[model samples]
Target: MRRLLALLVLLVLPLAGAHAQGDPPGVKGLFLLTDYPSQTVRAGEVTTIRVKVNNAGLVPEPLALSLQGVPAGWKADILGGGQPVAAVMAGVNQDVTVQIRVEVPKDAKPGSQNLVLNARGQIGQQASLPLTLTVGTETPAKLSLKSRLPSLRGTPRSAFEYTLTVGNDSGKDLTVALSAQGPANFQSTFTEGFGSNEISSIPIEAGQTKDIKLKVTPPRDVKAGDYPVLVKVAAEGATAEMRVTLQVSGQGKLALSTKDGRLSGEAEIGKASTYTLILNNDGTAPVEEVEMSGTVPANWKVEFNPKTIPSIAPNDKKEVQVAVTPADKAIAGDYVASFRANGRGEQASADFRITVTTSTLWGIVGVGVIAVALLVLLGAVARFGRR
Candidate 1:
């Protein structure tokens, strides 16, 4: 009977020790905040605040947290803990997120406002996690236009290229429209987003930059001068403008000089003789308003199609055709003629040599006549001898 009683006392002693070590009365979990940005808020903007609560006691505990000291027009939301954060184990932490929205008036003064967030539970309470909110007006955006190559100067018919740099110095993204104006004959081709007369939109991110290529081609007839071109850039909130100058110059060109200035064709003295003269513009600029003049022998007549050409660019060549006809009374021989083309800078000339020969049909007729004469003479001699 004594052995049984001693065993009962051993078991009872262990149960009492376990009951004392389980959990203290009214002990709760520790509430910790995580995943929250620094304690600052933008006036009239919505911000999210997040935190985690941990049960640091030996047993599971339920937690309830509340927010305090928010602005009049602001509201706070407890997204994670509507049902009272329940069953958190000892030494383990639970996560909670709180979203706070602050609405500042349009005419709100520019200054700093104070705010506080509180966390509470059945056994413990933590108050006033300090946060600061600022209220101010935002500044407008500013945009600017700059050019990589500001001036274009070249000879007529030469290609002029430029690169423009568009910058957005504002705190927000901006869309800029671009346009350019220049002379009528001066052709300009901009990149896809740019246009000659129409404004095209180009999106530039905040504090970003972009490059646009502009190409210009002057007309061959454009004279040397300082022509002003306007480039305009406009945005929804801002506008910018720039100017470009185009200078044209005349350059002495190399030309082809014709040495052989004559042409010949076999004709029955009245047939036509065709002559070709080549005019080359070797100058750096194009040549326009070309006038051609040619002189032929008195016995021959001259006719040319398109006696004058409108224009010819540099390093370009044009041919002028001249038709000459000899008079019926003229003899078959060589003929000489000269031609000149008057252009913008200088004159080009060609000398032509022409040879006139008898027709093949006339030669055949002469041979036939000689053969008939020989036959006739032979026949007369034979008849005389026989007589």
Candidate 2:
């Protein structure tokens, strides 16, 4: 009886060690096992591995799953039943499919990565699934096109400049054709350097970058807003493109002048003189809220008929009546007055020389005095001749 009991205990020890917690429900003999396919992936790519869990138990079994030894910047997800799950159920004597989704980072290096898939049951049944991932060193078709200044601001009918770079990683020399697509009437040109001659294409060596300048000119009548320009660089069969934004600034030009284009005018002391001032908008946009102001000499008053102009259309002109009055005691001489018209951050100014003459009353008094002296002199001459 002692020999038989010792042999029985020895047989039970092996069974207990095989399952520390015990076997799962309805699983009398077999332990948890996991099987999956291996993978070979490239950096900046994603691939999925299929894993099948086999359960030979008499009833369904839930197994906890986990992954280990995943590299930095790499992602792994275990999914069951078409959804991401940490645990899966396997029917009796059936295989449950689990998906292992992996994503390799763009900067990942080429190497062999070891991954372990661990599955644990509540009854202490556990299995580790080993997976090997081979990362390829082959560089993908590479071409990067970017701009130093992707967006710019300028007025219509002006030129905007941008510096662009093209990178080649094709392990050979690449001749890239350059082109730009923009709105109607928008002109674009590519140059090897700033202010250099234009070119239609450029070449870059392996692992090298080339810099080029792009000059974009909008139409003369483009509205004040944003526009898009697409720049493309193409090699043998590869293409790279970038979109550059051009912010159009509004133009408000207030050109001030007189109808006769003369900056000088005549005036009389203690009297008013009127002149027609012309305001022209030479820009592609309208000028608004235009106000006229003048710098006058002492005791002189300058006034505008409208005081403030409502608006001036592009390439259009408006007239304002300017009235100048000298002080009551102003002397008769030449004086200068500076006038400026301002509109929405735009201004134009001109200086005028105002020649002031004496009042009409003074002129009439001098003429009467001259006439009296002449008459008296004439009568004196007649009397002397008679004598």
Candidate 3:
């Protein structure tokens, strides 16, 4: 019986420290620690702190977590795996890290502040950890450029807009000039958020930030590829740069259309009619060695003037005359014809309907027959009257 009592004492001794701290029985080795839980950041900046929980207990424990004593206008969250967590499951004798993201407001005062986090486990098991963060009035550098999105995609002639926040950490107001360098024929501009006013330079107050919009436009003739653009902002004593990537997609485009309003026109049998067709390059690259061809009905002929064009630049148009002829013995009806213009990597086609009609001589002969019949009737009436 004495030996049995001694075994019970050994078990109760391990939990004495836990009971003194008001933690649940048999719950020990729960610690909140981190290598970088405290840091100094600029005002209006966002910072993240890592808190590691080392659970040496044999059983898994779900610990409820929360942030306490957060400043006004500041946001704080306990995140696990990039998302907020209501509770963290601590494995036996293992370590897990949780992230705390702290967003400081722009109007926050510059000073040192302390934040506390409370974690509660099963059976009234609780732990409170304190973290320190220092806010500096001045940023690390005199000029800082921040962009939410640095890469964008578009087709040739597509417009790309990016919003960037420029911070002036200097103690005085600064006049900042903005510029960008990109491929030839590309256009870019800077503008303020309000009034859409185009601005080459802007003034930022001391320790303040301003938002700028960068609008980039690739030329219609630009090739399909990745183009890197560097945006630079410079002041009297500071400079900042940001690199933007523009992805241009799709091959060149070609279009074929008739100059006249009618895709269908009237023509006489056994004769040829002329129509004008235009080939347009609406894509990025120049089309070279463009060959023209057509599909027509049996025994019909189609011809194109100039045979083929040497080259057509982007956004430019070239005119070609097409002469279509029908067979002499062919009947008057409607016929469909398709024409094509092809280049190295692009092609365009257009369909047309040709309506055939008889010659005017047939109409004139019918009119003569009617007139002769009227004369004959008049003669018969005169002879009958005399009798």
Better of 1 and 3 by lDDT: 3
Cα lDDT tens digits, model 1, 1-387, are 999999999988854554455434464445554554344444555555555454433233444445555556665555544433323223332233444444555455667777655555455434346656666566567778788668878877678777788888865578878778888877766664354442256789878987776677777767678787787777776877788888878764535443263333344477886656667776666777888777777877877766888888767887777777777677778777776777766677656666777778878999999999999999999999897
- Candidate 3 per-residue lDDT over residues 1-387, each given as its tens digit: 999999999988755643554445565667787786677766777787888876655466788988888988899988999998878877665667899989988888888888998878886667778888888776333888889998898877579998989888876578889988988888999998554888999999877999999999988777778999899988885899989988887556789997765688877777899889989998866888999999988898899996899999878999999999987777989999999999987899989999988889977998999999999999999999899
Model 1 lDDT on a 0 to 1 scale: 0.65
Model 2's number of clashes is 0
TM-score of every candidate relative to the true structure: 0.43, 0.48, 0.44
**Candidate lDDT values, in order:** 0.65, 0.83, 0.83
Candidate 3 global lDDT: 0.83
> Distance from true position, residue 169, model 3, in Å?
12
State the lDDT at 111 in candidate 2.
Answer: 84
Number of the predicted model whose TM-score against the real structure is largest:
2
lDDT minimum window of 10 residues, candidate 1: 85-94
Tens digits of per-residue lDDT, candidate 2, 1-387, equal 999999999988755554454344446532334343465677887777887776654356678889999998899999776688999776555667788999989998888899998878888666777888988875545688987789999998579999999899775568889999999989999999645888998879877998999999998667788999999999888889999999998787777898889889899887889999898998868888899999898888999887898889988999888899999899888999988898886789989899989978888999999999999999999999898
Clashing pairs in 3: none
Where model 2 places Cα greater than 4 Å from the true spot, the runs are 1-144, 147-154, 157-159, 174-203, 219-221, 234-243, 257-266, 276-289, 297-299, 305-321, 327-336, 351-358, 383-387
